[model samples]
Target: MASNAQRRDVTRERILKAAARLLSEEGPSAVTTRRVAHEAGLQPPALYRLFQDKDDLLDATAEHVFAGHLANKLTTAPSDDPVEDLRAGWNLQIGFGLANPYVFGLLLDPARARDTPGQAKGLLILAERVHRIAAAGRLRVSEERAINLIHSAGIGTVHTLLALPPERSDPHLADAAFEAIARAVLTDEPAAPAQDPAAVIASFRSLLPDLPNLTEAEAALLDEWLQR
Candidate 1:
C-alpha cells in the first residue's frame, strides 16, 4: 500500500496535470474546481482539501509551468561574451512568454510577481547575467539599474506582443527593444577602449579635487589641459 504522503503527492500531481491540460486545451475559463476535479478523478471538495482555493491552484499551475521554462533557460550554455549571453536570455524569456500566454500572464503580473517564488527566481537569474557584464567592464550603469532596465523592457515587450493578434505583431520588436536596451546600458565597445583620451581626461578630472600635492592654481591649470 502507498504511504499517506506518497498518495497525497500522487493526488497533487494528478490535480496539477489535470488543471494544466484544461488550461491548455480550453483556456483559463475551463480550469474550474469542478472541471479539474472531474478530470483528476476527484470530487470538487477534494480540490479544496489539496489547494486552498481556485487561485491557489492556478498559482501552483503557473509556477509549475514557469519552473520548467526557467530550468530549460538555466541549462543553456552561456556565451563567453556577456552581452551575447544577455541577448540569448532575452530571447528565451520572450519565447517562453509567447508560447505560454496564460502562464506568462500570471507570472508577469507586477503585483503577483513579487509574491511568486518562480518569478523572483527568474529575476535573480537575469541579475546574475547582468552582474557578469558589470564584472567585464562592459556595463555603463550600475548593476541594479541595468537589471531593472532589462527586466522592465522584457516584461513590456512580452505584454505588448501578447496583446496583439499574432498576424499584426511586429516580428522585429523584440530584437529592436533589446538593441536599444543594450546600447543604453552597455559601453559602445567591449571593456572600454584602451588609452581612450576622453576616458583618461575624465579619470584625471575626478581625482583633481583630492590631490593634496597639487595647489588649487596648479589643479586649475591641469584641468584646463584635461579639457583640451
Candidate 2:
C-alpha cells in the first residue's frame, strides 16, 4: 500500500495536471476547485486539503507551467558572446509569455509573484545574464539597474502584446522594445573605449595580474594607479 504522503503527492500531481489542462483548454474560468477535483478523480475537499484556496491552487499551477518554460530555457546552448546570450534569453522570455498567456498572466502579476519560487528562478536567470554582460565590460549601467530596465521592458512588451487581439498584435513590438532597452543598458561595442571610465578602470584592474612583462609589485602599483 502507498504511504499517506505518497498518496498525497500523487493526488497533488493529478490535480495540477488536470488544472493545467483545463487552464490551457478553457482558460482560468474552467479551473474551479470542483472542476479540477472532478477532472483529477478526487473529491473537492481534497483540493482544500492540498491548497489553501483557489488562488493558492492557481499559483501552484502557474509555477508548474513556469518550470517547464525554465527547463527549456536552461537547455538552450549559450552563445559565446554575453550580449548575444542576453538577447537570446530576452527572446525566450517573450516567446514563453506570448505562447502561454494564461500561465504568464498569473506569473507576471506583482501580487502573485512575491515568494513564488518559479518567478524567482526566472529573475535569477536574468540577473546572471546581466552579470555576464557587466563582466564582459558591455553593460552601461549597474547590474541591478540593467536587470530592472530589461525586466520592465520585457514584461511591458508581453502585456502589451497579450492585450491586443492576435490579428492586431504588432510582430515587431518585442524586438523593438528589446533593441531600445539594449541600447540604453549596453555599450555599442564590447571593448572599453565606449565604457564608463570607472567601469573600464575596474575591468582593467581585474586583468592586472595577467598583464605580460609586469612584475607583481609593478602590477600592484598599476592597480593603485587605476583605482586612482
Please give each candidate's TM-score: 0.79, 0.82
Each candidate: what lDDT? 0.81, 0.84
User: How do the residues 1-228 of candidate 1 rate in per-residue lDDT, one tens digit apiece?
Assistant: 999999989999999999988876787788899999999999998889889988788889888888878888888887889789999999999998888888877666666664667888898999878877765667766566688999999989999998999789899999999999998887765444463434334444545677899989999998778666
**Candidate 2 vs. true structure, TM-score:** 0.82
Clashing pairs for model 1 are none
TM-score of 1: 0.79
Question: Which candidate number would show the highest TM-score if scored against the true structure?
Answer: 2
Tens-digit lDDT track of model 2 for 1-228: 999999989999999999999988888888999999999998999999999989889989989988988998988876879888998899999998888899988877777766677778888999878877766777766666788999989999999998999789899999999899988988776655654765565446545666899898998888668656
